[model samples]
Target chain A: MSIDAIHPDWVAVDWGTTHVRVWLMSHDGRVLDHRRSDQGMGRLDQDQFEPVLTDLLAGVPPSQSLPVLICGMAGSRQGWTEAPYVATPCSPPGIGQATRARCKTWDVRILPGVKQASPADVMRGEETQIAGVLLEEPTFSGVLCLPGTHNKWVRIVKGRIVSFQTFMTGELFALLEGQSVLRHSVATRGWDADAFDIGVSQGLDQPHALAGALFSLRAESLLNDLSGTAARARLSGLLIGAELAATRPLWRDHKVAVLGGNDVAQSYEAALAAQGAVLHALDIDTPTLSGLRAAYAHLKETT
Target chain B: MSIDAIHPDWVAVDWGTTHVRVWLMSHDGRVLDHRRSDQGMGRLDQDQFEPVLTDLLAGVPPSQSLPVLICGMAGSRQGWTEAPYVATPCSPPGIGQATRARCKTWDVRILPGVKQASPADVMRGEETQIAGVLLEEPTFSGVLCLPGTHNKWVRIVKGRIVSFQTFMTGELFALLEGQSVLRHSVATRGWDADAFDIGVSQGLDQPHALAGALFSLRAESLLNDLSGTAARARLSGLLIGAELAATRPLWRDHKVAVLGGNDVAQSYEAALAAQGAVLHALDIDTPTLSGLRAAYAHLKETT
Candidate 1:
């Protein structure tokens, strides 16, 4: 809590669509102070990005003109500055590809995102997270499944991102369970492992019956009084199962790492485990922060 | 225009969730005067049904106490009158099964819906549509593909709905286009036949790639300057192709009737036709009206 003791070396920011998290770092690679605001890249106009960051940093007075390393959607086209994506079959982008943002108060650099050319895939902030993963296990070569609104599955070999694909599974689940007609049938909060497992099984087994499977949830609720909790779990299972149906086979025998500790992430863990996948998992913030820190260190070394 | 010349014997109404469509019928099965309103079953309270119908019929005064035969969501449990579902492998319900709603001005009959036991499927308004199809072809023994918000695929054997499945394709399309992230990429209007065909081909050929396929639309738009019009059409094609993947196998060679002339229905027709389906198309209102008239006549003959 002693702000005077923290003459921070630099700052790390994960300025995504919904939130902007700032972390003041000490010279010893430790987080001296961390704060976040709802003023994400989504909330700010092109001109407001610098001011927003300035306001977000007013509390933690970093004595020196520190380098402000930003990641996530802040590098997107609609973001504060367009950090052009570095294509696949390459290592996670470092400061070499980081795009500089014009700011009066600080040296700001936004990390570049990764993109796949053929299947047309792109990820902005997740690239930093991948860089963080590589920091922990530099030679970690396999697949990384990052579950979120737009779930990303990346393939890595010899510390380089080979190819990746994005699935709107999380967003689809939210829309279907909360906004769609199935909203009437699904519970807001509850879990049933059996129901989820059954759903996953159905999703894996029935490739041509997704529409019917979705309708069946409503129908079962109507006909046999299927509980809302079960329906919710079942809905989750169905989506994850379908996602696995798309991605699991190629990596069934490979080492997979699922990120985060949320219920959705756990659901994926269980699903992948159900499908005979030995998953290596990580906590939520470790990778993003690590990636940012790694980027800062790499920048210093290269300079 | 001539409400005076039309002495209606009965009234037929398709009061679905969103709109109330009323047809004034003569004793000889002529649609003398027809009217409709936005006061659908979804908007009305249990008590409001009578008044809504009364308001919808205020202009066209049928001379006598008309036997109002209503179908669609008006028969749902949440609707005006709860006309419970009749299990599959039976002809569409008639007066014997129609639940009479307590109305002072009219003898109101809400027809029962059809339900499947195994896969757990139900249809309210769509059953009436199916019955209407049967009215046109009494000995119909094929699959009926009714494309709508919840698209219904019914298997008809000896004029009975033996089995049926419902898909949320239309609803999903609406959500993905208007509400989801892909909304940024998808055009509200325009068509590209080539894009649609390619999407359809992908949906049919690649069973394990829906999520990637969907995300590709946005990525392509961002990375490859994929046009919005083509994206919209491609979106439609992908959904229809997936639906076809689920259904086309069983009923590919079966005599198929695609009802309605909406762009979505036409897309389905094109997709089905692409998959070698020689489709039998029908104008929208005929089958529904015929189904109601046939029900009325059957009610009279049985009485």
Candidate 2:
């Protein structure tokens, strides 16, 4: 198919702290082209974003002024352009609340992050993912678990985010495994299911002793000759277990839809299953694309 | 007094992971001279320890084979010489269990660390301090809390270390303050008492929710405009409170003696007081020197 014959309907972008991903969608709801780069908001200055983004969209036809919808950290004050946060107890912000970038070639709009004032929580990209979920299953109302560097647990009632909480699980794990004394005991790569389960149980049962438990991993290596693989698994389990213990109220009664990458989502699934909670895993990419699609449709109708 | 006229009786050293501290003691039990350097075990190889020690002791009179008693990481498996650990449920290892260093000029003995087989815990330098605690009060029986990078909570009964637990409170605090995203919301040098107390109460009340609570600090900074100083104080309080919550069984009914640096010990004292526990703070330097003195006495008698 010639580029001139088949014009892209719109473009979707997920700009995070450390990465940038872009997808071109056909009018018939088909993925035409996809590209990714390390040129994320975290690595770009205000003036640098335009050039980097322009380079990413170089493959697009010169005449095609397709509407590009952006989400995640790109909307933060420090990103491409500030897209003010949309308060919760509301549906995800669409094109109506999006901020426009000063670009001539592309009609670009950046999605706003979601903020909860009372508990003081804010999310940029996950809110769009939730919107994607609501688009696919408009009646889907329950808890949404999005695991990443900073994992988010969201409650949805009648297709709107009610309240949410975030955990420093992923960041804490990275710090412990990479920088803490536990680094000496755990391997950078490996896992042990038994040790993981044991650590999870301990974390759930007695979270106040987390600091002590973390130290024991190192002590066990020196004393009982514990393996690096087992140590890694246990460290992950301990962190995830503590997160689960804290979010019990969110998952105890409601069925959860986990939106994350494969490994992290599986970990959460295993943990939630142990808690006897029903959960379905969903790949983060699909919903993010769907969310961008939904926002594009909204833009078409509103404009 | 001239260095030639007043010869030192023995040298006491506390060589930890990050720093080397040494003190010269007289025959009359008076401190002759004291010196410190950044030549900790963590920064050097096995071969470098002797040279560092010799340089630190260059001021001493020549031809004097001064007896040197050392404790801490300098005796770890990877240290200057492997000082075999003394299995716990016993008194701190004295000269009998001390390992001799292959030194030509100085008669050096490295103190052995204490290890617990079950539950897998170990302590190197703190055990010496614990022995020092016993030298002054032979019948003191209670909990001794040592706060540092790895905080040790020791159980003492009739001048012997019965059991103990290690918490990574200080290490965790340092990591969060220096590396984590929470670093942006915490001042490097400032504190808020109210925020600290509030964090302590919350951490003690719901330690399982610590990960969530930590995130809230960042959120509060963005949403509710929480101060960096307050956030820093609160972060410290939460970690300490969680540790206190875990060690409640050890300190609830018994009087606690906190042996640590001034600031850290004071923090623990405040946390313990809030828990309605009888607590006293002791400077770590005194007990460390005393322990080395006691070890030197044992060395003199055994020889």
Candidate 3:
């Protein structure tokens, strides 16, 4: 079949739980304009999603009638219709099924997330972002980490996602510092590098001793009168230790690319660097848009 | 000063978050009477603590009241007043300040929890339980595993709590199966021994490979058509694997006494047995009560 070159009105939509972003693109897929909203799929009920999308794209010209591709939690079971998960060890722009948005005039298709059997992990929109990364850097082979509430570490083998793992590091931190008894003992200060480094070292040195290490935060405060900042460091060490232990196998010989915000990615980079692993960082936002666009392009080619 | 031996009525209280238990006893520390109420210190405002205690012990003759000993979360800063933490490498039933509970008519003292400095770990009621175990079996030396929301594996030497560690295994299992994406893929069937054994073996073997193994559950289902039960098993394996990695250091050489409910304790026993460690099971509920009573007896003799 001869590929039909279609001029897409909007480049892509990276609609996640906490944020929604849309890109306006030219015929060749250059981003001409962009818009973002905090009305993430996570915050809205299923029925309210269509109107919100319409409201966000109200200014776009109707005559352009561009194909809009969506990805992220917008395709989750709780979001729009559940987009089937594509099996792993598959190429970027892995085959994704299209679901029509509940709007008549807007033709929208959500990209499917990817699932892997070995290591038993799954990713939603991040898979598409990974696809974008693969699209941009086809020769790169190693580990790609997307840090968030449920941090994902994906293995890329020659542009294919072979396997992946998810760590609830961010969520666990939030739960411990915000909800558990440890909250009262810890200070609400920002990150501390000395503490972070101490944590990372301890994490790597005594990964199996995490539970005991966690209690040490309280002990340090009571015995040596360790400051709350130090307590925070101890907590960080416990969490990072668990993460390191969980991710060590996947990262044994591979170089690593971190895809997330600067702060989160930086901590992971430091941890990996300490372990003598080569590291790279990609802007999470751009790759997400690129991935969405890639999926849109794939859809346009097929239908 | 010579130790005073008083034949006063002894009161033992186990004050936790959701419930408060009190035992009125003879001078020999035999339970003459017992009482329980929903007025745990966790539920009451700081100011209401004295009044609630007064209400709970309204009928007890003030003259017969001896020193009241308390344990558990009541000593947390948010509970009553922060009972100071006792540092490690100390004697059995480590030295801690006896803080007065918020009641005037009764002379109340709360037990301080044990703390470690190097790894920053602490535990409150477990120390007292260790004390009770020591009091009961003075020559007993082994790893005492207390499994719960935050499982504790404590080391005992003679009658004192020498060192200890904690695990968030239970909490992690709950979060993964109940809250995370794995929830959709797992089955709620009872324990699967083969799956459990697989998890234990994998956990002990590759403590560091846990995160990657977790993603494989979903991948295996997609690529190999695994059953929901098998998916659940894989998830269990990932968690158990991480836990084993975190806890391997403590269980490496020490003889282990699994202290918890039947199922939880049994699971740990089986896991440890697979690793060729000597394991014993102890009823968690009885030891806690026995420990409280022992504390009461000590208070009666020393006051």
Candidate 4:
């Protein structure tokens, strides 16, 4: 089909704190077009979301009122609209339970975030991705290690989320590398496996010594001329090792399904493999697109 | 004596990364005048150190070629003149081995920082404080916990520093509470002991679970309406608890003497006490001043 020949049946969005991603879908579930923008929840006020969405879709030829299914921080209380969370021990909410945002020319549905009451936790866009995972494999049961800025180690029993924990590992790494004194020692690129292994081992062996271990990076840089590549890898390894140490209960005896971006997922895979665990890597796009499709399907049938 | 009646016999300086503290002393060891400046090592170039010191002392009446004993980052590689490290398992460097900076009117000696070759660690100002502590007690031996921006837990055997480790706990706490996502959940002031104890206990128990525990602060804030005071205390307890978990070998069996500003030192004392560790709280100024005195005495006898 030519660029302007076909019209999108629906739009799937993954809006987060820093970026917004959109996939234009045909009625038959094919991706017609994809778009991205930096106008995320962190940058927009409540009333500005619809206008941004309109602008993003301006290039697409006019069609009948398009169905827009959005997931992620856009559903947060501080985002476009408050799509109150669905408590855990339950299935991920779909179009039937999603909150609706008023728009002049479109029917917009935002998937609700997930919440855990006891320990107090929440997940926005990951829940949709989880739904996508579930759609891909209905019988899969194990721990899902979703690596990202706020990494989520989710425990899935059958299909429902039993429990999950979030780690500030990725965020912490960025802050330390970009702002802390360790920035001088850790390089922005080129990783060393041996250094990473050393860091992981140290972190796992003396998890409590993390604060001390961090300072060693700076000292080593000053005294021993530790390269940035080595420091970067080691820093990653240390944090992931500490995370794995704390999360041993989730993936120790059971097989784990690693999900998320390739680089971060590989890092987790390596760390998990070091512990002698069975693992499988799943492409992140599969679940996210699949979850969005599932949500669209639900919206079609329900309303 | 009136404020301007007595002239300083010598000057003692404790220059750190963020602040410079000067003590003008009489011949009888009395503090004749005291001044502080924001012109710390981090702020000044190597040449600026001499000029800055001269400006800070311009107001005080001068004596002929007064002796200036300097410690802290002023002795670091990037500070004034690099006072090379004295390796561990040795007494803190004395005036006999101090580095003389090129100053026109003052006899300035910068105390060397301490380094541990094996673990790759170093301390600039704390070593001087350790010396002061030893001078006061004369026969004391154990671990000295020095809390500050970068906290140090030093293991002392007899009069020498056997080994020491540094923790970025204070720095981590500041970053998390001031810059990270947890900032919104943690209060700038006020504290809850129960929350702190809970965080500390959880940190010690899981040691590896720290990264996850941090995220819970934000989660609880959203889901449970957790108070900011509670989150603040909990965050502190978690970091300190993790430190304690790592340093159990150093302080579990041996008594610890804590030296730092009032608030931070108290936090460590509480955390340590909860672990059944005996601790003595020493005023921070006590050891810093005493250490400078001991170094001055060393200079008097030698030079």
Kindly list the per-residue Cα lDDT of model 4 for residues A26-133, writing each as its tens digit: 877899888899999989999899888877776676543788899999998789889999998888778888898877667788999999997788999998888999
Evaluate model 4: give its lDDT: 0.87
Candidate 4 CAPRI category = medium
Please identify model 4 stretches exceeding 4 Å from their true place: A1-7, A61-64, A283-286, B1-7, B60-64, B281-284
**Residue B27 of model 2, lDDT score:** 63
* Positional deviation of residue B238's Cα in model 3 after best superposition, in angstroms: 5.1
lDDT of 2 at B113: 97
- Assess candidate 2 and give its TM-score to the true structure: 0.94
* Model 4: DockQ score: 0.75
For residues B169-277, could you state the per-residue lDDT of candidate 1 as single tens digits? 8888999999898998999989999999988888887755776789999999999999999999888888877888888665676888777777777887888888888
**TM-score (chain A only) of candidate 4:** 0.95
True contacts kept of each: 0.73, 0.94, 0.47, 0.86
Clashing pairs in 4: none
**Superposed Cα deviation of residue B193, candidate 4 (Å):** 1.5
Task: Report model 1's TM-score to 2 decimal places.
Answer: 0.94
Each prediction's TM-score against the native? 0.94, 0.94, 0.84, 0.94
Model 2 pairs whose backbones collide:
none
lDDT of 4 by residue, B1-303 (tens): 334444688999999999999998976789988899999998888889988998778756554378899999998877999999888888877887789988876888899999898789988999889988888776678999999888999988887899999998998999999989898789999989999999889888877889999999999999988999999999999999999898998889787988875888888888898889988655446687788899888777876
What's the lDDT for all of these models?
0.85, 0.87, 0.70, 0.87
The residue-by-residue lDDT of candidate 2 on A2-31, one tens digit each, is 333335788899999899998878876789
